[model samples]
Target: MQISRTTLAVLVVWLAAVAAWLVVAKPDMKTVQILAGEMAPATMSADGELPQRPPADADWRPLDQRVLAGWRDPYWLRWRSTAPAVQGGADRALRFSLRGASRLYWNGRPLAGNGIVGRTVAEERPGRLDIVRVLPPSAGAGTDELVVLASSQHQGLRLLSADAFAVVAPAELLYGQAMLPWLIAAFATGALAAAYLYFLAVQRGRRRRPGARLLLALCAVGLALPMVEGWRALVGYAYPWHGPRLFVLLGLHMAAAMLLPAYLARHFGLSVPMGVRIAYPATLVAVAAFMPGFDARSAAVLLLSLLASAGLLLRVQGAQEERGPILALVLAGALAMAVAHSAFLDGPYFLLLAILMGFLLLRHAAHLRALDRHNAKLREERAQLSLQLLQRGIHPHWLMNTLTCLQELIEQAPPRASRLVESLAEQFDRLRDSSTRQSVSLEDELALCRSHLDIVGLASDHPLSLQVEADDTRLSLPPGILHAQIENALTHAGTGACAQHPFRLRVRRDNDRWTLELRSARGSAPHRGRGTGTRYIEASLATAYPDGWRFVQGVDGADWCGRIELTCAS
Candidate 1:
């Protein structure tokens, strides 16, 4: 799994959120202890004198007391402090328990609670005493007071008692201690995300394998959720119950881990086993149970599942040739997270995972691009071979052979042969001129047909008849394509047989296509024979007029007839 730029940006936001939580809502642990202990007791005075007993809720009077802050629910309140007339240190801490949900504040500073506690709508006892350090008399005398605010959505607070004691140093406060792990987690997750995003951007332009993008997306999501939850936890936004949020966080972590093996298998082209599919999801479920009273048994289950999944991935990597870099990245990220979890080091582990994913994505993309280029080259070579074959079929040898036969006839029959010679010369001249062109006018082809008939008339004892009923001015054809059809008719209508039965040629044009029909008797009982000339004509028609040409041959009574239909070229 690779991390993209978007994922890194998301992690950065999560880090910033955690930082903000630490700054704005962090509890003043030092002040909370002092106010809870000494200031709370001194503030229970009437005017400048000590009160007879704790003030009643309805008859409580607002008096000038020592400056003390109290945190309850989400609110904080502060009041003046005053010393008690009695020199007793019996009340050193303020104790209260919330029936539903509440916060405590002392000296205008909110005390960070252990997050939401107690079960949903479940009855529970109140006044769970939390120890606190007392404030000095000079720090605001005895005028301080403790305040507790209850959640309107749940239950109210029940007051327990107060106490007084010497204040502890700021260094010993719970604020810093609680924040340490969160900060570490943020750093680790952020680093992993950054690395992954960079790799994804660099490789996005290249070709990639199927599911590569999806794998990257899943890895990115997994890395992101942990950072978000860790930040919330650090800021005291996380629920103390740890039933739902913890489960979700653990699930996200497991999902991200599971995606790792699958991603590596695809990136490095390793085969994934069937067991891995079942084990990965099961691992996530096991880890998710951690939030809902997960014990040693649940932890063992999670551990065993993870071990099996890791073994499967390792086996797949070992079977492949290119597994070193991918395996190293996965192992390093996993080890870093493991160490952080054990030590409660809160930082951005996602960042590391992201970087590893980016590397895999880039490798896969490059491989796909190379394969595409190879396939393209092969296609080009195939096209070139096909062109060479076409060139051989239409060479000039056939034309030269026909010209040699016409030359011998010119000297044998002086007058008739001279006419035949002129026609042959005109037909060859036109063919030569149009050799480089794909099409010519239909009128031109008709003239060429007349010339062909003249040459046949001179060579054979039989008469050659031609009837062209066409709007020649509006018609045209591929240069050499139609000529082959005429040649086929002449070749198949044998000269000796044609003396008894004359050969006939007819041409008609309609719409954009022209049709040619030739008829000649066999002079004896018709017998089927190979027609090489016809095959050549059909092949030429197919090559030149691919979209619109048809040739048909059949016996009509005593005559062997061949018909050709072709669309006129524009």
Candidate 2:
């Protein structure tokens, strides 16, 4: 899509925000988890200290796999595993992202502690959710057992498991924690801005398009995504919040999945069956319920949504053959990116969605332009119809004048009267054919002029000739305008004067401007102010060319002259 000044400004602001955040937070990191996953529980001493020897308890279970017993006020969890190879240096550390305050022990030696861990609620102090403690250089590969004495007496969220502890370099842990909030904030800001802009556009439009609501829905989804996925980074809630956080994330995913098909259906002017809508969400919930983890549930929902939207798009591909395949490709690419990353609502995912939104905005702008053009054409047509109706009102008076001439001719000379009759008939035929039209060719108008002169000349005793000066007779002008001008000149000038010189007609073109001039020999009949014919000529020009045309008439030297100047649209 073509970016407007407002969008460019928004982009510049977003970039500035990101730059400022990077400068402030200074987090450069990677998702390199050297050691992370389920840690089996082991027995610890009554004093919340590590045992000198390994626990022989066969009841060891993955911390994340089993819910901790609620009755155990002060919990002592232990795990033993072969340490992974790492550079033995002062930079190495253990990162603990836990719900409750806790102290750690590495290989039976005191490592570090966060806040205060006690057996009772009054003795415990809440700590920062993320804690990083430097490891001694000797504790790298030599470390064998890790013990955690955690108490959930002051947890905001009642988390049951402590499986977020990981081994990493202190810099990496700090960087990851610092970078997360910035990333989430940046994307969330962008999504919110996009949603506000779309909302404003929808509100300002005189006629809302079919895709308008769909765009708003997409923006809403985009805004919700970063907020849902990155709430932890923004707010350091206790680890217990993870459960509710995952629930909210899964719910948003399912809602977005259902929203996609509906958005597509509405955008493409297709009707979605109520059954399909109901079944899709039911299916998503059913599948998500059986999923083992939040990541799996999220990925499944994304894939199902992709398939559902694609199914609808493809089913109606026959109606929108050109757009269907392209939309499918974009949807497939977006879903694939999202599914590939366990944290599906990340920066890259939103970037793809922004691109898709831009494309849709461009299409909507094009559609609006097309509608504007169509409306303009309709207005022009209505004006033409109105002009034609006005011209019809003048026909009765004109016919009476002609019949009077015919009556005079029949009594003066029956032989010439027949020719006048034919000319009158031909004039009526051409006028009937041209009346329903907006414009007629210059040649057709000239023929009409010649027919009018014939009927007048044959009826009156004066034989007249029409002097033409023009090139490119195929040019078009409002129908019957030239004919009307000729009739006006004859009726006002009193044919006795026009019998001295033939009427003059000229057509000229210069670039996009067109000029038509008609001059009649001055008659003794005094010029009368604007007549019905004059009003008719003025109205026709105003209707056809609006403000793009000028009309002027007066007696110039020895002749009466009328000039029409207009700019033709390209």
Candidate 3:
């Protein structure tokens, strides 16, 4: 499938985020070679020295786990593990990452200490958490000895381990470890910013879709994942917090696993079965619990969530257009997780979430735009229907009044009846011609009004006449707008009253506006509120101008007047 603009835009955002990370973190690519599986417990040491060997009674524990505990003062930790055979003349080093001040030794040969190890906080000088010592060529392929004189007297938090002490391939390897956290943190920061923008977009839209809730939830997890992944770099916590950190990280991943499917369900407007809701997270937890390591567990949870969402989407009926993009994204996420299984949580996982959330935001924006357009079209159609209804209303009332006048005149004066019939026929012809048009020139509207008045004059004893003083007659307005006003004036103002004062129409130009005023004498009849004529006038004005038009009609001194203001054409 072709990539959408939104998806491409999302990709651009993700790339920008990655670029920002690279600029800030400047990470090294070199990899560290962990030496052994375990290290002996640390014991208090008075003098900083390379031990002949680890004590016989020392308790051995896994290197990757808590290797030192219950100690507040200075101590020595030792490790003896087979080193990878160094190629002749190849550069190699010992990498140490520790929380406190430390001095180190390799194979009984003294090396530069990270910082001074002291018995008390007053004398303790904290060291760089990560340091490297180049290994001598004579250091053979057999078992290598490593000893660290470590002190935590300067540290405020009680840590369980002294961090990692391992045989690194080169100096760059130590730099990589030091920079990894920052790199992850930078990526997380960018993703976090993107998520915040996505949330703002959700808030700014006119129509908030159900998918918005899911997009927000995705953003929430997008927020948490980076924090969990880059916590070490962002916070600089001691080693003691590592276990709790992992627990929290794992907990977040589990929550995300549960949330992703729900998010997808909400996003696509699909109703998820209760079985899957219960089974999916349960399966995620079950699989994650058996994973070999925290990274594997995290990856498993994310990958499974994506696959499950894909499966759910597959069953969605009649929504192929909606289903395709999200399906592709979830599948891509699953594939990315599978490929980056080992380091998914480190940085790749954050990148994946950014891409997914970005695409969702883009799609949501597109959906909202489409919704707005649809609503606008609906409003336009409804306005057109109303205008048509008003247009249709005028014919019946005008025809009925003319026929009544013709019948009366036929009996009273046959010659006058013939003239009224001719005027009626001419008015009908004008109406038929203007019926198909949305708007007509003011000149044509005046002709129709004159014809209408001729019929009224021939039929009534007190005939009505129209007087027009227009600055320009070519100005366009909705068909029959002024004609309806005249009819209303003759009906409510009374033909007898109009016969005395005469009906007046004056059109003038002022700046960018054209003002038309209709003046007539009001009859001594009870005041009637706005009627069908006023509605027609307003609806026609709205349909014609949509904006920049005004209508007002009420008593003005001795006469009844109606005013229409139309914006001039640019």
Question: Among these predicted structures, which one has the highest TM-score?
Answer: 2
Best by lDDT: 3
CA error at residue 531 for candidate 2, angstroms: 28
- Angstrom error at residue 201, model 3: 3.5
Residue 401, candidate 1: alpha-carbon lDDT: 50
RMSD of each: 18.3, 17.1, 15.3
Candidate 2 weakest lDDT stretch, 10 residues:
31-40
Please provide, for model 2 over 77-173, each residue's C-alpha lDDT reduced to its tens digit, 9 standing for 90 to 100. Answer: 5655445545455555666676666777766688768767666777877656776776665545653456777666664443334445555555655
Measured against the true structure, the TM-scores of the candidates, in listed sequence, are 0.39, 0.53, 0.52
Model 1, which residues run further than 4 Å from truth?
1-207, 233-244, 269-276, 283-287, 290-309, 316-322, 332-345, 348-352, 368-570
Write down the lDDT of every candidate, Cα atoms only. Answer: 0.48, 0.64, 0.68
- Please report, as a residue range, the 10-residue window in candidate 3 with the lowest summed lDDT: 23-32
Q: Tens-digit lDDT track for model 3 on 1-570?
A: 566654455556555654555454443333445566455545554575434455778776655445453454665566665545554534667766677777777767878987677667777777765566787654466666677777766555444444555655665554454565466555555756675686576558354566566667767777777776666654555443566777788887787777777877776668877896788777887877776667677778878888888888887876555566667667766776677575656665677676676566666677766766665664465456445644554458766876887888888888988988888788878877776677788888889889888877776767888898887776888777788777777777777778898888898987778999988886555653276666767766765664468999878888788899987563
How far residue 80's Cα lies from its native spot in candidate 3, in Å, is 5.4
Candidate 2 accuracy as TM-score: 0.53
